[model samples]
Target: MDNKIRLFTGGTQPTSVGPFAVNEAEQVETRPGNRPSPRELHVTGTAEVSYPADRASVRLSVGNNKTTVNEVTSSVSRRLEYILQAVRQHGVREEDITVRKFLHRDQEVYHMNAEVTVTFSDFDQMEHACSVLLEKLDRSVSVGQPRFFHSAECLNRVRQSACVSAVENAQQKASRISQLLGQSLGAPTLVREDETREWRSHGEDDEEEDGGGGRRGQEAASTQVTPLPRIPSVTASSRVSVYFRMRDGNRKKY
Candidate 1:
């Protein structure tokens, strides 16, 4: 029924005798059998690299309402033609632009909608595309922000970089520990790791692109189109567990 003894670091063990606590016993008994043993060191290391995305995906949606389904579809087509022309003028490959979905429905009234998507391999060309599409089309079209992704080659590089950093970090820690305890550190007996991932975003506008573009109010005056900035950085990290064998019967210093 005594909480004091239960809460002690040594708990209710028989050797709860002041300084001769569980910690001391653990150290004293560690080498009792005199068998070679190793100490574990756990630490984290991170590596990051930036590379331009290889591909970009953008979504464009056009909608129209008319008295009949036939009238709605024609209006949608007209709007799409302008957008398609704008995309071509901005250097987008014809094969890269494709319609993802098209629909015409009548629920008492007529409604039509079409979803168009474009893929780009060049970052500079992709940025100015949206504005070009907007300008060429007489009717308004909703454009979604672009999505960017690194190629497989970039991902492989990041993984290799992070693994190297983690090993170096572990070795550095082992050497420091050995020096503090007046002991020599042996080669690493084991190496393991934990993993993490990170993503970053960046944006570039037209006025900022050519160094002479303007805000929305200046759209009419601006001839050079501005493209959204490309996000080019991704990070992957790993933590290592390193074990170093002890030289003699003495426990390695903390």
Candidate 2:
């Protein structure tokens, strides 16, 4: 028995040689087909805009506990009606108001609660309604502070303005950098928004309303003066990454 070992070498095949790689004579050829990527300047720009809140929402609730369910219900319902009337008298539409009632029993005593929520476009009117409701209602009624926020349209506009400003800022930066490098700034090749951020300047707390305004200890001479209301400001920001083509200052394009 004869055992012979055969070795096969693998390399570039002659028939598969590309036309751009080798000529007919197979002497090896090259073409200047692959072009280098165009020079570009990448810059990131950010912009933020603060917009005043345009809408306000106020929540008022009445809760009481009594031996009988009917007694508790009567107490809550009386104040609930007054709150609704006060809100409506200040030009609030019916659709902008919401009402809810809940009843439960704890041991021998029954508890009843009623909540009213009203949305207002005018802050002054909202304040007036709240003042009137507080004056007429008993200490059992709890009135929450007004929650201010921007409407959908207002928020959308603010974000759009911020994005546009960011792009403009990027263009300005690219132009300045190009000038400093002794190159001419060319048209933008790519633009993309990398991130967006939004925040409020003030508190965004939930319904933390209490029947009593405050503890007697917290009151001081400074607290005696009525402080002006502080409306929250909504801020929207945008960050954009931009790529602009780099052109030779001395060269002219045909």
Cα lDDT, all candidates = 0.60, 0.73
Top candidate on TM-score is 2
Positional deviation of 223 in candidate 2, in angstroms?
4.9
Q: Which parts of model 2 have CA positions greater than 4 angstroms off? A: 1-39, 62-79, 103-113, 135-141, 149-158, 177-184, 202-229, 246-254
Structure candidate 1, residue pairs in collision: 127-227, 204-229, 206-226, 207-213
Query: How big is the positional error of residue 86 in model 2, measured in Å on the Cα after superposition?
Result: 3.1
lDDT of 1 by residue, 1-254 (tens): 10110111222222232321222222324566674333433333444444556778888999878888788888889888877777787788888888854565566677778888988777677768776676765356888888887768777777677767766866776676656756666554444444445564454542335345546446645665555455656666655444444343254433
TM-score of 1: 0.46
Where in model 1 is the C-alpha error above 4 Å? Answer: 1-46, 50-54, 85-98, 105-108, 149-153, 164-232, 238-254
- Model 2, TM vs. native: 0.57
| Candidate 2 clashing pairs, residues 3+ apart or interchain | none
**True lDDT of residue 107, candidate 1:** 68
